[model samples]
Target: MWKWETEEHAKAVVVIIHSAFEHHRWYAWLIEKLRVEGYHVVMGDLPGHGEEGKYSRIHDETVNEYIKYIKNLMESALSYELPVYMIGHGLGGTLAVHYLKKNKVACAGVILSSPWFALQKHGSLIKSALANLGSLTSNMKLTLDINKKALTNNLQGYQEMDDNLVYKTNVTVSWYKEIQLIMKNLFVPSTSQLAIPILLMTAKQDKITDVEQARKWLLLQSSTEFQFKEWPLSYHNLFHDLEREQVFMYVRDFINNTTRGLGYIID
Candidate 1:
């Protein structure tokens, strides 16, 4: 349980989920933006990445288990009876897509900033072979970091993060194994039943995840209400980039347009 940013008289509640190796407070600026736009925002520390955790423990769980944590989080917030909207980055985006595919959580829509359809900056043939092979073998941690530099644009800001307070569980063997499976679910070829609209923002310069792969993933989506934007100057952490205010505005306006029944899907 993290916190509710507004006094509770918000027009809607925006729930934010952060990427791996980061904590909930990482979305502080985005939360502020939503507050200014007259929305209540709630953010919680994911199981392993924040101050408090659970009986099951984050590192010990498989990727599907981790996804269940996200759904449980959404269910708890939906109980508050505010129309919910979800914004997730990287690993968080993957979780959001899973929620859309499997559950009918009543959300206004979803915003996915650089969703991890495929990990970034790797030899395509080699990476695919390894990813597939790892799925069959006992080795769980065979995956490699695609772009290590994309971890943070603000090195000082990253260093200032509390060292004792872990931000994420290290990417595990089973986690990598599970990601291949989750990716399969994301691009499921048929049964167009996605219940909510989606907005996907990718960075042309993002080194951690392939922006082209993200575009392909969006293409495979069965939902017609899908939008994609490629920010030429942005990196993996677009929400925290120098032009972050613009990113925030993009999200706010998208929410408003969707709420007003404007079919503003883009690419």
Candidate 2:
């Protein structure tokens, strides 16, 4: 189900997508901020996380399945007769990119916060290759979430979040493979037929996704309307970082600027 807040004079709709092991509540502050600013805010739980039933481990999910969920959500919002904008973090960010590439999903713009384009630290190519082999041979439950430092540094509040609210962080081999496929598609040309603006945030000290790779991907874009910000003092989860207020300001400015230009937002 979707939870939403609309101001009396709302002008635009903003949809917040959660990270891989997290629920939609991760964007609770952002949603409230947007609603207070007269923008309608909508968020929902994705399959295998939050309110949705866990179908299988992370690796077991196919990209098509994830895309279907996003498409259905976007369609449902369109049914309500509202202009939609997308804001996604981590794996959710990657899913947003896939959605923009595949469909003419109407949106004023898109905001990506430290999207998981490439895992900076993890299994080697040889290990992944072997895992692929094993996956083909047997239905092995690849226990891939071994990174204890995931919620450290920038994500200090992660520990405060209940384990059940956020996922306990276990993944399978197929999930890693799915991530690899998504990353591979990143370097390919952008298929968005719409000239919707894009905002991408990267953490300078992030240990999870490869910041440099994200930079390279952004550079490949021919559109100059895109905005890129690198937070030198922040880590992976920019929204929950110690300097999160600054990050939120960045987010607010981007949304305000682009939507104002389109005449869909004011102030």
- RMSD of every candidate to native, in Å, equals 4.6, 2.9
> Tens digits of per-residue lDDT for model 1 on 1-267?
555656535666787887765677666667777777767777776656665542323343466666677777787767767667899888889877876777766877899998878875432336567656644444333324443346546554344343465333434556565676786677767574455778899887788887787788777766667788888777788886645667777888778777666442322
lDDT of each: 0.68, 0.72
| TM per prediction | 0.81, 0.86
- How high is the lDDT of residue 176 in model 2? 67
Q: Candidate 2: list runs displaced more than 4 Å.
A: 53-59, 80-82, 123-138, 146-149, 152-156, 190-194
Which candidate leads the pack in TM-score? 2
- Tens digit of per-residue lDDT, candidate 2, span 1-267: 475666557667777777777777666667776777767776787667765544444435567877888887777666656667788888888888878877876677888899988877654335656545544523444454424356446444555444554354665656666777888887877555325788899888787888888878777765568989999877788877767788888877887788678766464
What is the lDDT for 25 in model 2?
69
Looking at model 1, which ten-residue stretch has the lowest summed lDDT?
52-61
What's the lDDT for residue 44 in model 2?
A: 80
Query: What is the alpha-carbon RMSD of candidate 2 to the true structure?
Result: 2.9
